[model samples]
Target: MGVIAMDKKQITLYYSSENSIGKQLNAYVESSGKDHLTIDISKTNVTGTQWAELADGLNKNISDLVNTDHPDFKEAYGENSVDLDDDGWLKILNKNPSLLKNAIVIKGKDFIELTSASDFKQYMDPDSAGIEKPY
Candidate 1:
């Protein structure tokens, strides 16, 4: 009998701003040979619940990679500004949405929401992620 191999897909998260945790995550995902995806929420409108879902997916992805025995996972996990925990994940989601929501709400505009991990990851350039060669 032959064993079947599942195709591994990498997810990358990108943000327009620099000097933020999202940038660090982008670097991490790229170095890990994972698929690159980006979501530009800068001009998009999103609901609070949608933001929460995106954050949850990111949190889960990081957790899964870190828990694996992959060497690069440790470095990637450590590079984040937010610690890996349920509360921490929620904090990130809330903070990001709140930051955008507050500005938009005050101006009576809609805020952008990241719906899913894949939605965000689709924007990253694979080469930029630095995952060209497996370690």
Candidate 2:
């Protein structure tokens, strides 16, 4: 039989220069031998459509993506107030990208947000996605 090659899934990492953790996550992904492109959301303007798509990929609500602790968030919505929908949160993120959560990974059709370094292991697991591991 002839040799067969499975197409590799594409990986895109969204990071920010201001966030040291995000920079570390980018390095970790690279060292893990995964092929990916890095986009600095702080530098690049992310469109609402892209944000919506990412939200869809992770099956995440926009409120889940918001950094509630961010100053912008606190200033806009006081600690006790709770009356914002997903679209409203998305709009806040679009206007204040700094209020966005960090280290978003887009692998093929899968969208993920890595809050910690260990989360990368989930993607490396074969049962999870049959993705290649660095070690």
Candidate 3:
């Protein structure tokens, strides 16, 4: 099997300024000395292709991409009704991007969610987490 290498330069972030974790991620990326494209889903729309790319980066784990705790989601479906398949979650996110998780950091073909400020440091300095760069 051929191994795929990561292109660190091809980094993108989907984040919201309204969330603390997202705000911290934005600061980290700005100072991390890496080139990146930042998207605030609250103010802009993501195309279907872009959504697919984001989903792929998450290994198609739609639960990780969604904020089930968001009031809009909770009120509409109740707490236990989040058993959505990939397409179902994507459809919801397409209609309501604000319900997306705080921040998604896409580096090359891989991605990690910045759920907290500490997650930023852990993902950025992967060696400390006993993780090697995916290649």
Candidate 4:
């Protein structure tokens, strides 16, 4: 487990502000009024160990955290069945964080990879806690 992956009472968003989806995700989380920590990977450097822990926390392979179809990825490594182990994939992430697929929201001991705005409910469902409308 990553030491940084778990916060006591806040949502940790690992994302790049350079993308539209990421922007929307940030806004949604902000609107929730929950305490949050945003890590803009584009400007921040996440260590290899932290990245590995995040991947494991999400039950995914390190390569699965990458957008292999991204232009940068395609340019650097053509889609020629390039296979890499965990450490090898971590190197790619360490060197080029932009290739990351999506935001990773870590809350408590749980984490989810945000693919779209609709995915927010998984972490923010009001009914889960029986939070009624103020009406």
Candidate 5:
């Protein structure tokens, strides 16, 4: 049997307010010869189930691939970290493990932060909010 090499897949979720940033990012990615999947939280009736399904699909798609470090990640998350108080956002983040690095949390008109998969899991829950202290 021969060893198989999987392509590294990049996933980005743009949760921008007014739908501007997300749209622009989508276009930019597409023009750059990279395809991306998007979920419009503002237009879609994105229930917990829908979010779960999206997360599951993304996880399955990238299961065997590595992540390429891109400047977009830093741009989305910023050089420093952020603090959040919304339980709904926390719940969504905690439940979607695949969304770690690719996922971004936008609060109204502001981008909360970008998180690593591990850090995302650690500080995402309301109960785990204390983890934000170190950052």
Candidate 6:
């Protein structure tokens, strides 16, 4: 069978339950009252190809998807970890899903790295995204 493609009309969330930011992001996503998909990498196993696709969709590299500053990453790879190739990075993510730096939200063609719980709110209503419209 062919690979399953992401639904352009659905909002997809990639997050780790073990991460606080991911947990917070979930709250916002769930309450949005919109069609969405939530993937908890903590309990589920995400494939290397899937992780790579997410990174690519987010306009980032595999390494960028990892929170290198996280304690777990630092403990396992050291304070200053060595660089690895694309495949190597994907392997790291597939094996250690907790290394995800932040919650990623994808709505249609829009891909956003949810920096905060409310970050996804902007996508819901782009016109009133905390802009004062002082002009």
For each candidate, the alpha-carbon lDDT, in order, equals: 0.34, 0.69, 0.72, 0.80, 0.37, 0.77
Q: Write the per-residue lDDT of candidate 3 for residues 5-109, one digit (tens) a residue.
A: 336765677887766777777888788786777787777777656766666666766667788889888988897866777678778877777678768877766
Question: Least lDDT summed over 10 consecutive residues: which range in candidate 3?
Answer: 1-10
Comparing candidate 2 with candidate 4, which one achieves the higher lDDT?
A: 4
The C-alpha stretches of model 5 lying farther than 4 A from their native spots are: 1-7, 49-135
- Sum up the clashes in candidate 4: 0
The parts of candidate 4 lying over 4 Å away from their true place are: 128-135
Clashes of each: 14, 0, 0, 0, 1, 0
Best-to-worst order by TM-score is 6, 4, 3, 2, 5, 1
Better of 5 and 6 by TM-score: 6
* Model 2 segments more than 4 A misplaced: 1-8, 85-87, 125-135
Which of candidates 2 and 5 reaches a greater lDDT? 2
Candidate 3 clash pair list: none
TM-score of each: 0.28, 0.72, 0.74, 0.83, 0.30, 0.83
Give one digit per residue, the lDDT tens place, for model 2 in 1-135. Answer: 212111246577776656667777777777877676777777887766677776766788767777888776888888876678767877777677677775688765566788766677677666666654333
lDDT of 5 by residue, 1-135 (tens): 212111234333434323344455444444544333444444444454444433344443221111123344335545554333334443434443322334443222222333333433443343676633321
User: Which candidate gets the maximum TM-score versus the true structure?
Assistant: 6
Model 5, residue 42: C-alpha shift (Å): 1.7
Judge candidate 3 against the unseen true structure and give its global Cα lDDT, from 0 to 1. 0.72
lDDT sort, best first: 4, 6, 3, 2, 5, 1
- Mind giving the per-residue lDDT tens digits that candidate 6 earns over 1-135? 213255666778989888788898888888878778898988877787777777787788888998888887888889876689988887777778888888888765556787777676665665865421222
